[model samples]
Target: MPPRDPSALVAEMSRAEKLSLVRGTADPAERATGYLPGIERLDVPPLRLVDGPLGVRAEGERATAFPATLATAAAFDPALAREQGAAMGREAVAHDQHVLLAPGVNVVRVPHCGRNFEYLSEDPVLSGTVGAALVDGIQSEDVIATVKHYVANNQETSRTQVSAAVDERALREVYLPPFRAAVAAGVGSVMTAYNRVNGTYMSDHADLVGGVLKDEWGFDGYVVSDWYGLATTVGAATAGLDLEMPGVPAPGAEDHEGEWPDGIPDAGHAGLFGDPLAAAIDDGRVPSERLDEMARRVLGQMARIGLLDGRERTGELDSQRHRDLAERVAGRGTVLLENDGVLPLADDADVALLGPHVHEAKLGGGGSSETTPFHSVAPDEGLRARADGTVTTARGVPPVPSRSLFDRLPYLDWGRDDEESDRPEPSLDDAVDAAADADVAVVLVRDATTEAEDRDSLALPGRQDELVRAVAAANDRTVVVLRTGGPVETPWRDDVAAVVEQWYPGQADGDALAAVCYGDRDPGGRLPVTFAPADTYPASDARQFPGVDGTAHYDEGVFVGYRHFDAAGLDPTYPFGHGHSYADFAYGGVTADGTDRVTVPVENTSDRPGREVVQAYVEPPTVEGVDRPDRVFAGASPVELAAGERREVTVSLDDLAVRRYDPDGGWTVDAGTYGIAVGRSARDDRASVAVDR
Candidate 1:
């Protein structure tokens, strides 16, 4: 039989059945990240939600691990991101998952955020545009797509309890755009953040969750809580949170990682939604209608995806097509930060691979997004396979100590027993010797980041900086490849021959780097976030970031990333969207259709073909008593051009480009001349035009 109407099904179910649909439990199959058992009488199959953003991460199973979400954002191509999303959705179905907990839409407000690699960008326009496309593609396969961390989840420090004290103007302008875009794209699920927003917890935030998301935006999707994130049964549900993930902890918590102990509560109390919720409903503390709506939403999704029907829905794992996509995305998203004719090495040049990552692949930053793929290629393996000349390897320094959320505790240590952390220190002298002898030295370095922790500094962790400087001194032909979660300080940039920002490329790391090194593919990625000294970032101080007491203040307001750089007149080491192509592009005939869109003619004037990411920035009209960035990222489009090819490129503007959020007036447009610039990066504007708003 086809699926029955959700409302009709709800009418038939008892209170217990309705409760089952709104709470997560352990999966009997032991494969999914979160599970809800189905009612056999109603013929509703078990609903499973899996963790993925990099790729489908099935528990204790192998899947295709693609590059990090940050890498996808670096490409500045929503179409490519959508393709990746669709592939992930298919893989989820292959693993028998109904929902994919992915495409985290949290804006990269803090540069040192531990999970920066998991997010898209610092700029709302870039994050929203790419995030919406990913959501659309995931849902195309009938797998429910989730856009997460509903409010400001920028930092990992004190995540569960800290309050993000942001004003209304900044909330509407900076933090809310991505979630709004995801809702606009019709995403099926929205996950609440672990932290509090303003003075209220996100799972219990009635103003933002109920008023803004549900009422104002007309969001019809179900809202789920972050694991162990539900505050009060009555408060959260009344505020519009519909589901409690992993509702009840297992019998023995110590036997399982991060699970709440039996009869013990997380933070202060045991789980709130199981028996406690039932008591609340009996006493009228919680209205029965809210519970009915929760059941309806879950059932509606099951019906929409054919989960309630007697049919089969499946996809393939480790498909050749997906593997090819992983390589293509990793290659395209590799940003060439600097190159003085040292890249595209000779096919037979003797290569020296130096760094701790030479042996192990830089899959991704740790935590939920971590995926275990069937196969992964290391940097040395990739170079050896692709190079005709001899490829030598050396460990310049031992791997950096991986930090965890438990690092502050003297007793508790997470994952220390699992991973071998006491390996003998590698020889740094051998790396310098190898660099001196080899024709070209490619030094790969990485920052040890995890979901439970935030980096204290943007400089490369450990003595990797020392190793890079020594290697550069040993051989002037040294190329540094950073496999980090976010931007890092590059003091030796001027000394090195070239620099490549390959942010946590997954299973295809080696192959992608090899291809870019040998000119098999062009470095098509750009910087999604600016690279600068650690002290210069917007949320630099303790009071503004991790917070002094229990609240993180958004003091910078709407000024973030490039907006902050332009407004404060500070020079970044590498501006946002900064990247070099093998071939140069010439811009001409730049035109603006008022504040709506911009178009420009681009010609590949170089002898080789290349990919160009044309960015459109809109300079807002000046108004007294109002502050705005000199230019805001409106929209961007990527174009592939053959040698001597010329074509016209048009980029549509996001509504944010022409409007600003006012405290009293709401969204208001300033009337004056708006300047539009078409360029390769934020600072390198090639052409400009003006329009009256």
Candidate 2:
């Protein structure tokens, strides 16, 4: 039989049943991150929501752990991103989950944003395109994919209280594109951010949610507020928020990231969405039809996923295929930021592995994105397996402390922080000695970031900076590997022989590192976010960042990431899309068709296989009264080439490249000549073409 109509089911549901569908309830299995129970009499199954972007994060369950979304974004390969999404979807379904809270499309506005690792990119076109692919991949598995943190949720500091003062055009052009793309791709759900936009809580914002998203964009999915992110009952209900998560009030009501208060087990339930919503509807504070709409949306998603028909969903976990894919992504996403002929180390040479937790796999950053893999490979172990010569190890500094209050909590700590607590003390002298004695010294350092908090600075935490200097001084051939969630200031970049950016490459971290270091895999990753000093970004001011009083101002408009760098004429530590390869790729010639398409011929000049990301930037026409960036990232295509192979890469310009957001006219195309630059990075332009529109 076909899926039942959601309208009919909503008509049958009473007020109580409708309210139940609108709020989360207790999960009997206690495995899901969130749970929503439908009407039992109508046989509507409860939706099991799991925290998944990196992997399926069902409590106490093991799944295939993939790299950070930032890592995937670095690859600039949507095919890989979609594959990861499908793999995660299957894993969630294996654990009987219905909704996957994933594909966080929020633009990386702040380098210090603790949750930057969870997002895609600073450029909207890249983030939006990749995010939509993830949504398509997840929904293809018949699971509801949630595109989240709604709008302008850039910082983690005071996320629950601080308001992001974004203008209307900024929202349309900079922050809202990714969410819009996800919606356009037919994503099943939208998650509101825990923060506020322009002093109005997103959960209760009618103009954006109800008018812009639902009315203008025609998003036909349910709008669920983030856990404990709801503001008001009637306001949210009337504002087009279809669901409130966790059903009850959390343990620490004020602290969005805090644990359950004192004695509360699992999660608390104060029933804010339960009785309060019903009361509002009964007393006419909220329209009765709004409740019906909520129930219909929930049922609609269930029907779409085949849950209403009691379809059996089975998926593989810890499969060899998934394991290999994990390693493949980690390898492909490895960005070589700098090098001086010291990489792809000699297989027979003695190597010194020096860093904190060389024995532990740097899986990922903390909070909801964490996943417990069946097994993990440490860098030391992986290097030992791959290298033909002796591999000595020494800790360069004390282990970086995971500064999350939630890290100590039982249910939330899925990545096994307890196992890491009793680590042995490190000695700097031993590290220096090891470096001096070895043919090459590999120093691994990482910055700690987690949810519910923002990093104090872009500087590496603890004594790692000191450690890098010491090791570099001891051995001239010091190869520094940064296993961070996002960009960090490399104050000692010039001192090192080479620098590798392996952004939190999940469970296969060790294997990926070994392969890349030993020349088995080429550095295929590129900088997704620009590397800059702590104070160089558009929001360098205290008032613009963590905010003053109550609001954080977004005064820079559309100038974010490389756009900011270009407009301000400031050079970053490393430009966006900058990366190195063992093989060199030469661009022959580039031509554009005045509008939609740009064609470039590229060849691998070196005798090694390589992957090249062909990037195209568009310079919009000069409108007399309008102001725009120096250039906007249009689109890119990743090319795979064998040695001595020549191929033509076609990069289709994004429709939004020449468009400007007009408050009165919506997105409009300026009638003038447009310039398109084709290059490997934001700053390096290989060729240029003009378009008259």
lDDT of 2 at 604: 95
Q: What TM-score against the true fold does each predicted structure earn?
A: 0.96, 0.96
Q: Whole-model Cα lDDT per candidate?
A: 0.88, 0.87
Clashing pairs in 2: 248-270, 248-271, 249-270
lDDT tens digits by residue: candidate 2, 260-319: 432122334345678888889779998888888888888889998898887777776788
Mind giving the per-residue lDDT tens digits that candidate 1 earns over 616-664? 9989887998988899899998999999999999999898988899999
Quote the positional error of residue 606 for candidate 2 in Å.
0.5
Clashes of 1: 2
How many clashes does each candidate structure show, in the order listed? Answer: 2, 3
